[model samples]
Target: MSFKITIQPSGHTFPAAADDSILEGALAHGLLLPYSCRNGACGVCKGRILAGNVDYGEYQDTTLTHAEKAAGMALFCCAKPLSDLVIESHEVSRAQEIPVKMLPCRVEKMQKVADDVMVLWLKLPANERLQFLAGQYIDILQKDDKPRSFSLANAPHDDGLLELHVRHIPGGTFTEQVFTRMRERDILRIKGPLGTFFLREDNDRPIIFVASGTGFAPVKAIIEHALKIGFQREMHFYWGVRKVSDLYMLDKIGEWEKLGIRFTPVVSDEAWHGRTGFVHDAVLQDFSDLSAYAVYACGAPVMVQAAHRDFSAQRGLQDDAFFSDMFTFAPKQ
Candidate 1:
């Protein structure tokens, strides 16, 4: 049977199915509740069950002590509602709300999403999860002198496994391995949830997201997160690639279009049926004034710089409204 749950203070409420933990139900309904390990090991998800009964599922002894439990506290990540519940908890509204972590993960899956892009899924050890704000990049720690960094391509609410989009750069050893020899079950060390390019949720302005080549990685993360939270702000996403082949993940973008997200795929190197020329130019051609909008751009430095410069100077967008992350080549091994 399904039960209802109400979060205190915010007064946000959602229905929870019998098999779903409180956290799962909340996330599925676009609620960004504060959580970490998802498994009950981390007390970050602990909160008072102000009213109603719950099946506090499996948890670590030290995490939810008897005293805390006796006081009606429960780990939302593992707790299943036994009846309608009123919970005292708050949403995570900032990047600092979650802790960064250094973890080793096994390459669980990989897909050649584009001619030069490999989408990888990294699985943490059992009961382990990495909490991160959307749009953050992670440094892949290798034995090489310098580590490589890649933006996470998955949304925070769906963080069972970490996802990254890696571009195959010629002469880049790590990327070369990823394209050529990296195998499933390979272990990789990562330091992350780094960078400050996440979506600014507090603002109510419409959003324009620009992505070039592989820079779409972080933008994908941010867009998915924004969509999951049920944000209704006007969203215009422009992803520019050299050729049609370079534009991967169209399926995901197409899904967004169904939800009213304006999607413009700009192809620079080839003639296409869709919009053409520089991605930023497409934005300029469409929107005469951007001052009222927030623009997040990622990918090649050239594109990010161009978007930052033009969107502010020509389109009247505020400098602060233009957020960007430039993809730079990692130091060679």
Candidate 2:
């Protein structure tokens, strides 16, 4: 049976079926309730059940102590409704609302998709999952060196294995190890679900995604999430690379095109028989005005800067309408 669930203060209400976790129901309604480790290992999703009964599904005893339970608290991640409910919980409307986590993960698999790009799949420990929005990144921790940040390529819905596309850089320490020595079952520490470079879902504005090199990682995440949620906004995706060989995931791109999302692959430096030159300029060439589009740009710092300057000043895109994440490379040592 389905029951009505109401949020205190906000007074927002949504329907929750008997089998759906409180978090699941809220998310299905586009109501962002704070959550982490949706498996109930983390207490980040704990909140007061101000009214009505709940199943309070399986969870670690320590995460939801008897004292807290008696005080009307329940772990929303594991709790399922028994009747209509009113819950006292804050919504996660901003990136900062999600908790950051540091956890150990195993390299479950690795595939070299291109000459310089290696896709790594990381598996979190049992009962632990990192909660994050699409397009966020994680920092791979190192014992004797600084952490290396990589964008999560998989959307939140398909987060069983954290996907990361790591590009090899000449003289780079970590990437050199990844390309030369890292193997499956290798243990690694990661901290995140970080960054603000995510989709702004509040509006119905058409989106123009500009990605370069491995910047395609985060853009892939956002686009996948958008598609999963059946976002009806018009989307145009342009991916740029140094050469034709630098472009990977053509099969997946082909699938997305069939679903109505426009895809343009731009190759700079060396070209075949497709779009060439700077990726941003291709957008300029296609659209006479971008005043109504929301542009999300990622990749090299120079390309991001150029897109930001030209799109707003030349193409009439509003300054606030453009969002970007500049991929900075490690310095050669």
Whose TM-score is greatest here?
1
Off by over 4 Å in 2: 1-6, 11-18, 28-30, 50-53, 65-71, 82-86, 331-333
lDDT tens per residue, model 1, 1-333: 999999999998999998999999998776778776788987888899999999999999999999999999999999999999999998876767767788889999999988899999999988777778789888998896587989898988888889999999999989999999999999999987788889888788899999999888888888898888787799988999998999887888889899999888999999979988999999999989998999999988899898888888898998778788889895321
- Report the lDDT tens digits of candidate 2 across residue range 1-333: 899999988999999899999988887666777776788887888999999999999999999999999999999989999999999998877888888889999999999999999999999987788778889889888886688889999987676899999999988888999999999999999989788999898877899999999999999998998887678899999999999999999999999999988999999999589999999999999999999999999999999999999998899999989998888764211
Would you estimate the TM-scores of all the predictions?
0.93, 0.90
- TM-score of candidate 2 against the unseen true structure: 0.90
Q: Model 1 has how many clashing residue pairs?
A: 0
> For model 1, which pairs clash?
none
Candidates' RMSD to native: 2.2, 2.8
How many angstroms is residue 304 displaced in model 1 relative to the true structure, after the best TM-score fit?
0.9
For residue 55, model 1's alpha carbon misses the true position, in angstroms, by 0.9
Model 2 clashing residue pairs (backbone) = none
